[model samples]
Target: MTGKVLPLGLPLAIGFVAQLAISFTDAALVTRLGARELAGVTLALSVFSMTMLFGLGIVTAATPKLAAAHRSRDTGAVRTWYVQGAWLAVLVGLLGTAVLWQTRDILTLLGQSPSSARIAQRYNTGAAVGLPFFLLYVNARGLLTGVGRPKPVTWVMLAAVPVNLGLGCLLTFGAGPVPGLGVFGAGLASTLVRALVVVAVTAVLLGGGFRELALRGARLVPRPAMLLDLARVGVWIGARILLGEGFLPVLAFFVARFGADATTAHAIGLRLESLVVVFALGFSGAATTVAAWARADGDWRALRDLRSSLLLIGLVYSLGLSAVILASSGFTGRVVFGLHEPKAEGMLHKLVFLVVAYFVVDTLITMSMGYLVGLSDTRLPTLVVAAGYWVVGLGTGVLLSELTPLDFYGLWLGVITGGCVIAVFVFARTGQHIASLANSTTEEAPE
Candidate 1:
């Protein structure tokens, strides 16, 4: 199990971290501008993430499908899947870009301060410009993972990190020839990195074995039925992603009620906590890939082994991470954010613990969702996500923030509560599904 999963999991995790490194870079650089600019940048990033997620979910449906095709050695089908998903990615990216570019009026309507909204709009212009490229990159990434050839993604991301960081610093802070552009520059630099990554990976795909598929006429035409199938899956998955990720933006919206500094603090907390998220996602992706193969092979024993492996590994990893985050509270304050005041220091420490708790529950939720998604079971999970994130998480946060002593701390409590519900429901669903598979296999066995 380790041999099967580690190869896939490690690269996916590393690539995701590199992908998120841009966000950390933005937060750190923008902090120099003051809390207001930090708040604005954070808001812009959340909006961009939500917008990108729509495309991400849509394109992601292809992963398990492609994995199944690869497992069956259906080369033509694999090529067709990639081609159609590429078209869908372009369409989704274009529309998402247009929507995010127009977020100024939307932010104002959502009750954001005019100054913050303006800055967010300015930053989003650059982010919006690169949305299509990011979408294309996401599609390519899914293909690599689905085919169990994810090492290239790690290499590409490794190559891009320093490039991303260097450009971010240069454009953000201004070098000899360039004037500093602040939040907008941060956006521009990130977009540049996104564009470059797509180009790099595309070249690799075309130059490698995928080129044969490209030359085989699979890239030229669209299959309407499969395209619709992908979109159908994407819609539910997209909604799930929207609900899950939208929690932060929603929390940020409410946090603004506390003050700009509070909003900045929330944003910073989320950015730091993303360190946990990248690893959880790595395991989730591995689970999905492994589950895809199990379903394709109709191997219940492998499925059981995969689940057990995930549980043992996830438990140990989450505990170690929680301990590290708890111990690093002072380090995060002193080194990461440089919080000087006692009040600010205390607030960040409190938020870190809340984030740790949320990460633990979310780990189980993410792993369960990954396995289920591999089976193409997204609709029910969508409802679960909405209930957990919106109904449980948001509901708890609102109650605590408004009526109780927890204040904004109550918001993160909502996050944990919601995640717990999601974890239980998803794991139960997975158990039932696996049991059904086992029963059917038993019935089909020779007498």
Candidate 2:
């Protein structure tokens, strides 16, 4: 039982590392281009992220369905779900691109400077062009993860990051005859690489990637019901994402009061947080895999084991990360934020403790929620995320900023406090569900 869960989970952990590597690569490369340039990339990435992640969540919701089909050994159903998911992704991608294309002005109104705004527009445009391909690739990963084939997704992700970084640098920094295109060039390169990854993953999957499973190719068509079901699940997840995103504006408002230095500090610290969050996300992805399989196989015992194992692992992992950040505060700040770079005043030690502290709580909560989703108990967690983030985090941050001397600390504390509350609530909820399941099973057995 333990082995089964671990094998499924390991790939998610590795895939997370792959994503971190990309961020690290981007930070390293973009640091050379100046603060404004770095900021441009940051804004560009955020806009692209907001658009892409919503679709990603929707596509991923199909995983459990695919897993259930595979467990029933229904090859036709699995194929139908997979195709339906891919087409849905493609459709969403196209629609998102059109919307973004029409709304570049609206994005600028979100507070990016003219230069950064232009870069964001270009990046968003390119990103939208790649969205269909990108989502198709992700759909393939969802299918693979459903059948316990996450290793391929992990490996492809690992390979893709280096490819993206190398190409991004070659284009942005200009190697040989290629003139440097700076941030915009990097965006273009990344978009192209992601498109290629999608194509490659699709080709491999279609060409007998999982021959043992006998996955069949089917005609691709829009299944309105499946699409609607995916959207139903997606809307909650999207709401969760939006609630989390809402904090950014509040944080931005708080940072603005501190002037540019504080704002830059906040942005840098947030990116640093992303590194830590990725690990929890890895565990979360594993939980999704485990939950999908557990439900498919109708093995509640396996589900319980997987959940317990993940929680234990996540606790230790998050604590260790927090300790590392505390211990190597200076080195980490220097390496990640270009500490030697001028104008980033009082960055080291000042924001380090706050960001790490926030990450510790945030990661735990994210992992717990991911596990809940795997159990097909998403509504409560989704509600918890929305309320905690908006009411507890954003509301407190805004009110305190107007009333106290806490400054950015108040904002960050709101995030940490909200996340901790949600974590505690969800942890308790998951425990009760498990206990109830155990009791029900015992009661059903012969005395």
Candidate 3:
């Protein structure tokens, strides 16, 4: 299990971290511009991420579908899924960009400060330009992973890191002839790097044995039946993602009311926690592919092994990562980010333990969802996540933050509570579903 998962999961994990490195790099550099800058960019990024993640969820539906087709050597089905996913990616990307372009108006209506809104709008303008390309890259990534060729995508992403960093710095700080664009520069760099990544990955996809699959007698135009088929799965997945991960951006809106210091601290905490979150995502992606293949082969034993491996690995990895986060809290908060302000720094410290707890629980939820996605059991999990995040988590956080002295801490407490609820329900669902599958297989085997 480790052998199968690590090869795929490690590269996927590296790719995810590298992809996030663009934003993380932006945050690290933007911190030099001051807290207001960090706050504004963070707010903009939260909105961008919400939209991007939703679109990503929609596109990722292709992974399991493609994986199943590939495992059966159904070239026609593979081609169709890939092309349909690409078209869908384009459409979602366009819509997401439009929404991001309205960042200022949305922020204002949400009652955020005008200055922050204005700054966020500037950043959004640049970031929004990259939406289509980034979504395209995601779709391509799904295709590659489905075919068990994820290494190319990982390499392309790893290479993009330094390009983003150099471009971000040159545009942000301004040397000699160039004027410093500040937040806008950071956003612009992200856009350019996303475009470059898409081009590079696309080249690799075609240049590698996939050219025939992608271009041979393929319908470039969107077909309604195909689109509908993809949407049938994608919509549930998108909603699950929006509710499961989208809560952070909505929560950020609430945190904004507490002041820039709180918002800054919240943003920093999220960035640090995302490191481990990607690890979960990597494993989740691997689970999805492996599950799809196993299901296609009707291999019950493999499924059982998968569950055991995921549980043991997920627990050990989550705990180890949490410990690292706790130990490095001081260095990360003070020296690395340079959060010298007493209030902001102190609030950040208070958040470390809560962030660790949240990631641990969230990791389990992520792994379960990944396995379920591969099995094509998405609708119920979607509802489960919605109830946990929106109904239970956000509601509790709001009440605590508004009515109690816990303030910022209360918000996170609510988040952790919600995560716990999600973990329990999702794990239960996975166990029951797997047992049903095994029982059916056994009943049909001998008779």
Candidate 4:
């Protein structure tokens, strides 16, 4: 199990880490511009992250479907899933871009200050330009992963890291000929890098990187039935993501009401926390592939082993990450993010512990989502996540942050509580499904 899961999971993990490095690089650079600039870019990125991730969830539906098709050697089905997924990516990407282009108005209506709104709008305009290309890259990467060709996609993402760093620096601060565009330049650099990486991955796909799974002769036309099938699965996945992962951005809005210092601290903490979350996501993707293949083969025992292995791996990884974060919290505040303000640095240090706790619970929810996705079970999990995040998590956080003295700490505690609730429900569902599979296998065995 480790051999199969690690081989695939490691590259996906590394790729996710590299992908996150782009954002980390952007944040580090923007921090030098001062708190207001950081706050503004954070607001812009909050909207962009929510929209982009929802779209990513939609496109990610292709992975397990494609894995099943590949395992069965159904070339036509693979082509259909990939084509429809790409089309879905384009459509969703365009919608997200439009929403981001209106960031200023959106932020204003959300009650952010006018100055912050303006800066957010400027940053988002450039980020919006890359939405379609970024989504396309995600779709292509999903296709490759589903067909067990994730290494090429990983390489493309790894190579994009330095490019984004150099470009982001040049564009943000500017050289002799170019004027510093500030936050806007950071957004533009992200856009350009996304486009470049997508083109590279697409070239690999078309240039026989798929090996036995050729995409050359596939029809590019939009089939209503195929699109509808993808949507049926993808929409729930998107909602699940929006409700679960999207909770953070919404939480940011609430955090914003406390003032810029609070907002900046929260944003910084969330960014660091996401580094750990992405690692879980890498494992989740691998779980999806493995579970999908197991389901296609009707191998209940393999699925059971997957569950056990995932739990063990998730616990060990989360602990290791928590230790690293605890040790480096101070340095990260003083140096990495350059938070010279004593209040901000103090807030960040406190938040790091909560971030660690939150991610440990979050890892369970994430891994369960991946396993369930492989089983093609999304609707119930979506509802569960919605209730956990909005009714349980957000409601609790709001009450605590607004009404109690815990303030910022209360908000994080609320988030952790909600994550714990979500982890329980999803793991229960996973067990029920696995048990049913076991019972069915038993019934089918020779007596």
C-alpha lDDT of all candidate models, in order? 0.81, 0.72, 0.86, 0.86
lDDT of 2 at 72: 84
Model 4: how large is the Cα RMSD against the reference? 3.0
> Candidate 4: deviation at residue 115, Å?
3.1
Kindly report which residue stretches of model 2 are placed more than 4 angstroms away from their true locations once superposed. Answer: 20-37, 169-184, 245-249, 259-261, 340-351, 398-405, 435-447
lDDT of 3 by residue, 355-436 (tens): 9999888888888788888888888889988888888998899899999998977899999998999888877877776787
* Per-prediction TM-score to the true structure, in the order listed: 0.89, 0.87, 0.88, 0.89
> What lDDT would candidate 1 get against the real structure?
0.81
For 1-447, candidate 2 gives per-residue lDDT tens digits of 547656776787788688557645665677788887677666666666677777777776777778778878888888888888888788888876776563357557875668777766665665567667777777887788777777877888889888988888997789889898776667677678778778677666766667755544486678899888877776666667666655655577667787777787777787778767776776676677676666666566776787678767776787888888888877766785666544453643677787887787777776666666665576677788878877887778767666798777677778777887788897788777677667777787798
Higher-ranked by lDDT: 1 or 4: 4
User: lDDT, candidate 1, residue 334?
Assistant: 74
TM-score of model number 1? 0.89
Runs in model 4 deviating more than 4 A are: 28-38, 169-183, 248-268, 339-351, 394-408, 443-447
Tens-digit lDDT string for candidate 1 (99-198):
9988788889888999999999988987787888887887788778888888887899878878877887887789998898887888898889989988
For model 2, name the residue pairs that clash. Answer: none
